[model samples]
Target: MARMISAPVLSQEKRERYDAFRQERTFNAYSVGNDTVMTRIRHKSLDCSPGCAVEATLQLIDGKWKGVILYHLLQGTLRFNAIRKRLPNITQRMLTTQLRELERDGFVLRTVYPEVPPKVEYSLTTRGQTLEPVIMALKAWGDEHTTFGHVPEICADMKGSPTNS
Candidate 1:
C-alpha cells in the first residue's frame, strides 16, 4: 500500500503571475500556504563554457573589498580589529557585511571563542586558499602598474613599443 500527497493549488491568475516572476533573471518566489518565500537565483546552470567559468568566479568574489579582504586573510588568521586596522578606510559595518558574505560563500570561516569579551577570529577556508595565486598576481600587477603614491610622467625614450627600451 502507498500514500499519496497533495500540493496546494494556485488560481489561474496567480499561476500566470508566478510564471512571469520566474521569467526574471534575478530571483524567484514561491507561495506556501498564506506566506510567500523569495529566493535569489545567483547564476544560471553552468554549461562548461568559458563565459560561464568567468561568471561563476566573478560571482563568488564580486565586491569592491572582497578581493582585498581575501588578500589580507591569506597571511594568517586575524581578529576583527586586526583586519580593520589593515583596511582603515573600511567602515565597521561594511567589514561586518563583507565578512558575513564571505562566510556565507564558504570562502572564509568565522570562529567564536567562549570568553569574557567573545573573541572572534576570521580566517580563510581550504577553498579560499586556492585563490592565493590569483590574489598574488593582482598584487604584482598593481605594484608594477599603479601610480598611487608616485608622480605620473610620460616616457620619452620609448618608440611606440614596450620592448623598444
Candidate 2:
C-alpha cells in the first residue's frame, strides 16, 4: 500500500498569483502519489516588451546541443544513435537530457516501439518545425562567418581598421 498526500491550501493572494502565472506560461501537471507537481512546458511569459521576447525564445533553445539537434531533425526523423553519431562530441547522458528537455517543451516528439530492445525515434513537433527559419538563418550566418583554420575575411578587414588600433 502507498500513502497519499493532499495538496496544501493557498492563500487568496497566492491563488491569484498562481492563476496569473499559469496564464502567462504553459505547464504540465501530474500527480506523484496524491501530490500534484507542475512541470513547466513552455515559458510564454506575458511580458514580451523590449528584450523579453528574445529572452523567452532563447530560453526554449538555450542548450548548446539543442539548436544542432533541431537542425538535424529538420532533415527528418532520426533514431537516438543516429543523433548521437551526428553530435560526436556530446556524451550519451547529455544527449538524453537535451532530448528530454526538448520533448518536454513541445519541440520534439519521442516515439518508443515495444520491441526486443526497445526502438526509440525522435522527430520535431509542429511547434519545433516553426523554428526552421531561425535555425537556417543561424546556419547561414555560421557558414559565412566561421573559418575553420584560417582567419575570417571580416577579421582580416578589421585588422587594419581604426578600431583595431
Candidate 3:
C-alpha cells in the first residue's frame, strides 16, 4: 500500500509547529574538525494559504518570456536564433537566461548538435507539452479580448446570430 501525504494547512498552530520542527531539524550536514562546517541541513516550505495552485502554476511559467517561449515551441522545435526571432523584443541575454530556466524546470529541452559552429535547438519536453492546453486556452482568451486583433470569422459569424442572441 502507498501512503498519501496531504498538504498541510496554513494556520497559527501549523506555522508554530512548522517553525519548531524546522529549528529542531537543522544540523550540520558536513563538518571539518571542530572549527569549520561545510553545510547545514534545512527544510524549506512555501508558507502560503490553502489551495494555492495558481501561485504554483505561476512559479513555473510566470515570466513575460516563458509562456511566450512555450507558445512558440508548441508549433515544433526551433533553433536558438529562431526562438529569438519570434520574440524580437527580448534581449539575447534575457532569452538565454529564460531558456536556461525553463530547461532547468523540466519544461524545455536543450539539444546541442555536433557541427562546425555547434548548433543548438530548444523544444518542449513531455512535461512541457502538457502545458499545450494551458497555452491554447490563454491564446483563445487573448484572441477574444485583445484590442489590436479582430475576431475570427467563425466568431464574427456567430456574434449576431440567433443562437448567440
Candidate 4:
C-alpha cells in the first residue's frame, strides 16, 4: 500500500511524525552542494550486536536438527553415532552437514581418534557453551508450553519428575 506523501512531510521545517520515522530508520547521509545532509535506507550495520552476532548464533544453531544436536552435545562429548541415536528424525546427510557448519562457525568442537571403527566425538566450544543459557531458556519455555502436554525428558531431570506429576 502506498500513500501520496505530502510535500510538507519532505520539508526540513519538519513534522513530529517525520522526525520520529527518520530517527527509527537507518540512512546514508548525503551532502548537496556543501550545505545539506540527506538520508537513505540501506542494509543495517553489520557490527550491530543483535543484527550480526545474534544472527550468527541463530545460523549456527537454528533449524530442526541443530538445536537437538546442541542439546545432546551439552551433555558432554558424544560420538557421531550418539548424536544420531538422539536425533532419529534427522537424515544422516543433514546431520553431517549441520555438524560441519557448526564446527566451521566455532560453535562446536569435533575430535577424531584412531580406532578400528573410527570414532569421532563432538562437544561444545567455549563459544558454544555461551549458548547453554539460551538453549536452556528455550527448553524451559518449551516445557511450560509443550505440544505434547507433558514435560520433556530433559525437564524431568530438573524437577525429578514430569511436569504433570
> Could you give candidate 3's per-residue lDDT for residues 111-132 as a string of tens digits?
9999999999998999999999
State model 1's lDDT: 0.79
Task: For model 3, give the 10-residue run with minimal summed lDDT.
Answer: 34-43
Whole-model lDDT, model 4:
0.73
Q: Clashes per prediction?
A: 0, 0, 0, 0
- lDDT agreement with native, every candidate: 0.79, 0.82, 0.78, 0.73
Q: Is 3 or 4 the stronger prediction by TM-score?
A: 3
| C-alpha lDDT (0 to 100) for residue 32 of candidate 2 | 53
Q: Write down the TM-score of every candidate.
A: 0.64, 0.63, 0.61, 0.60
Q: TM-score winner among the candidates?
A: 1
Flag the better candidate by TM-score, 1 or 3: 1
Model 1 Cα displacement at 120 (Å)?
A: 0.2
Give the poorly placed runs of model 4, Cα more than 4 Å off: 1-45, 48-53, 149-165
**Ranking of candidates on lDDT, top first:** 2, 1, 3, 4
Put the candidates in TM-score order, highest first: 1, 2, 3, 4
The positional error of residue 92 in candidate 3, measured at the CA in angstroms, is 0.3
Q: Quote model 4's TM-score.
A: 0.60
Q: In model 2, which residue pairs have backbone atoms overlapping below 3 Å?
A: none
